[model samples]
Target: MKKRLSAAISSVGLILGTSLFSPAGAQEIDLYVDTVTKQVYTEPGKNRVKMGTFQQVQKGANRQDKKSSDRQAQKKTDQPAQKDSVQQARKDSSQQAQNEPGPAFVHEPLPERPKEEHWYDRMHIRGYTQFRNSTTVSGDKDAVVYWPDRSVGEDTSFLIRRARLILYGDITDNLYLYFQPDFASTPSGSTTGNFGQLRDAYADISFDDKKEFRVRLGQSKIPFSFENMQSSQNRLALDRADGINTCCRDERDIGAFFYWVPAEIRERFRELVANNLKGSGDYGVFAFGVYNGQGANRVELNNDMHMVARVTYPYQFSNGQIFEAGVEALHGRFVTSNGPVNGITPVMVAPAKGFVDERVAVHAVLYPQPFGLQAEWNWGRGPQLNGVQRLITESPLTGGYVQATYKYDSGPWGILFPFVKWQYYEGGQKFERNAPKNLVNDWELGVEWQVTKAIELTAVYHMMNRTDVLNAPYERFRADAVRFQVQWNY
Candidate 1:
């Protein structure tokens, strides 16, 4: 009985040892636990190398898993919050679009640029008008007086002496043009027709870089005399000197002229012109031209062309005073009339032909600051009615005018100038009908007062002696007149 019992115990021991040592039973187990929840879990497919006790390894794994799960939960919570923010932004943008009104047009920025100017934009326009009243104070009403040209008329009357408009501008940097017309003119001796007349239509071509040299083309003032070149608006005397006037009647002709001034004196010349102080602009220190010799408004009757030249020099004092001297010469052929010659008299013989005409003149001027002096003298040979020959013949001629003036500037009252002029002329006026001989000695006293920049008043008293006018040969006459004039500029 004892042996059997021992055998049973041995058998039991063997069976338990075999099961524990088998290959499946030898595989290691890795256990993991959640530390916070205190739960156990098995990690499959992992080899267990004993680093510490099972509880320590399991506790480390459970702590790492718990941190990872916490991180994931936080990420999940943040995603929904970010999505809500995006949806809210979309909603706000939609609300703003609905609140604003739609624009009518899209805004576009304009390119900045300069305005272009047309050619006419550079044009300058100006004009003047004159009203005059004259009366004969010493001569009979029907008697021919010393007054010549348009100044000769009925004794006591008011007349429009001049109404003129001027247009001028530059077409390019080097080209300039000027135009002027007169509306009020006296009736021609040949016809009662009095109409608007063109005075100047010309262009200036500059050659030098500084424009010190130029050529003037078309109808322009002949460069024969300083006074003739001086604009009517600037003249101190009511009329131009007879000496110069006789050479080139009306002073303008269709011509080509060369003008030149030294660059140094050009500014001074411009200042004189701008001041309207009895000086032509830098027309030149030297000038020359060729023109139709028959005078302004008359067609050329002969093929011969008139040639004119002038040389002038100006000196300025430190006290703003100017003195100028000039010499002039003109040569031309003159035809008295285009009418059919009757062949009865010398007058008819001369009118049927052309004659040599020549003139030389010298002039000096002292621009009136407070005191001034101006004088011109001329001598020439021209066609004249010789009373002795009872026919037209070439004869010696001489003429000139001397003037002195005193100017006072009263500030706001404007300028006042008192002047005296003496003129003597002995010549023949071929332009006048019948080639009338003219013998004139005249004295004029005048006062000019400038009320404003645009207005001026002048009064003149004249004493004269004249001969051989209006078909009367050797008939001497003395006449005097008082003239009043008002001028306005615009």
Candidate 2:
């Protein structure tokens, strides 16, 4: 009877304890889980727990309490495992979604990248070179006087005038980059080979297909005269501007420019040459902020020009010709060598003292049939240099040019183009018994032959008369030159 009673009491305690210990507290799904751990577990009363370490609870804390403690410890231990399991589930869900798709896609858009980072997205490359040999039968002068060469005068000569390499590309949909390097002839042929001096480095971004709301930054072409912007890689003539004012170097500045292009054409442009622009390829308005104006990769003692602005229009004629026209203004601040009463100081000069360096200009280029013509005119008033006693020119200065070129498209291995250029300019200090009115006029005859994609040959004859001088003798300085050149491009 006593044995039976003890057995019955033991059975009751066992039942009660078993009922209280619930595996539901583990609260897990989909596993034959043992509920063991990959991490340490702190019992209901224990301190901080660390992963992959062992922990134990004291004995006789109710012994029953110990069992409960172990279960509670399991819940804590599973916290991290729960996180890992959740991640795995998500990954699986995503894969399933991809497999069941009617064209899988992401809801979020991709991030945009800078132009420099996406250089090859939209890229274009081009390059050219010219060489020539000429037999001279003329007067006893050399190349343009500014750059005198005694190597060959009125006699025959062989030369390489242009050896060039160019790289141009676009980034994203609207940004662009362009570079040109002249490796052929140096400023003095071999005497000065300025390799890798960037010919052009600028980032361009535009709003749309019409290219409105555009910005260009870095070292780029100065929006100035026609000759200054024309590319040397392909000048229709052997000699540009009769080599009078055609160094065309210093035609760039390190700066940023803002521009707006128009979508429509105008009547005046159509009438002028079927189609014309402001020397700008499209109709637009432009404003520039130049940091250093003495071209790119150069250092100057004086400050650079502050602003250059222009309004322009283009015309597309029914005859398949194009023309452009524009008006522009400029304002610059600088310190002149003429000033600084003391050596340690810098005295600023007033650029607008005598006249408005403000200028009015008009340009037109015509492409009709076998002939092409381009012309520009500029008239502006400028500050006269202050003499020890002020003596300035009475009126603003005027300068311009009218140029024509005739080209015959490629036939066999060569293309022939003959061109003529004429210019007239006068702007100088009148104060000096030495300073006088200035003008330059030139005439050239030349032809080019392409020997290969990378090689070109050229031959030419030129004559020039320069009238800009400080008490220049005999009204003008004249020259006659004969040249031939050969070049390689890479």
Candidate 3:
């Protein structure tokens, strides 16, 4: 019995050892055990004990691996159904999300507001005053020689030609305003002089961001003549040409004007003024407007408005010299007032309806980049007194002036401009009380010294032969006069 049991145990040990050491692909092994001795064997026939075939345990593997394998196999069989279930769950979740409403409120940033500008910062103040004195050094002391600056002519009395205050500002990006008042104006026939008068009250509205197109409204300078449009403060000549000056009494009238200029050209115009080249400001490359026919500060007598138009351009050379040329024309009906002439004798009665007032002028300017020349001429028919008939009738008139000047920069000593001008006009003095027929032949030589930015001095000698339109028997008066003016700018 011991030999048999030993043999069975040895056989079982051999089978177990083979199963543990064999490769994973090896076949299962069969075994038997003796019931009484509990001895195992690989063959069933020897001990008459039977054991079923079993899984081969690989080397270093645990007994629980079979249970794990059974679970893995069951998971593989159920994979398709599980995958479908997961897909259906995702689809259901997406549909539920779409059916539900979103959150009640969402947070967002607010837009910022623009800062407002202060009134004081939106406006600017600037002005100039001219103190002047003039005497007829070699002519009749009582002879009245009408001057462009009517304040100083024959009297040696010291006077103020202009005491102006200007307020200008850009109210917004597209709107600009300009206002000026002259405190030194002397009203005709008034005993007291130096009364304040409106000079300019206008607004410029830009139509584009570049400000190339604009419209000016209210009382402003008429675009009738180049010299007429030039500001007296910037002019080198003490007086404007009588030919052009006669066309517009105060060089201004209530009107609306349109101006168009390229942005680049506008800068050049500003540079000319900033450099003291006597620029006319930005009058535009082309300008047209309608204004009251009765001149500045005067009531319109007729329903018809004065139509005026002008075209001008400044050309710059490679050497930085600028030249300009332009033409302007105006047509209107003017009613001469039968009122007392400067508180003097009333002349012939004017037409009840009005007289045809029309003119066409041409002007040229060479900005003094050292040396300059300016000239203007006009021809037209206007109301003038027929001395023999003593009636105000339309008469042909023509006149103009030519001026030459030189600009000198003296560094710290400031600057100087010496000019010579000769002017002739055979026309009607429409602004005068009688609308008298007048002839003006004048020669002037002057030097303007800009001692400083705030101070300026001008001295001019004039030889004038002009008709005395004030007195009843209008006679031509000749005089040699000298005038001096000092200007203060701020």
Best model per lDDT: 3
lDDT of each: 0.72, 0.49, 0.80
Query: lDDT of model 2 at residue 259?
Result: 66
What is the lDDT, from 0 to 100, of the residue 10 in candidate 2? 46
- Prediction 3 TM-score vs. true: 0.74
Candidate 1 all-Cα RMSD? 23.2
Best by TM-score: 1
Worst 10 residues of 1 by lDDT: 48-57
Worst 10 residues of 2 by lDDT: 31-40
lDDT of 2 by residue, 1-490 (tens): 4543343344333323333333333322221101221111122212212322112323455775646766676766655564454445434433432343232222445698755654575677777665555543444344333232323344434555555567777676687777776664354224544344466678888878655677888877766555455555444455434222321134666778776655444233233322221122322444445445433555553544546666655455687655555665555432222222223222223453222334556666665345777777776654333333233333456777787766565667555556666766665332223223455665666666556545656666766566423222314567666666665555
Which of candidates 1 and 2 reaches a greater TM-score? 1
For residue 476, what is the lDDT in candidate 3?
80
The residue pairs in collision within model 3 are: none
Better of 1 and 3 by TM-score: 1
Angstrom error at residue 108, model 1: 4.1
What TM-score goes with each of the models? 0.76, 0.56, 0.74
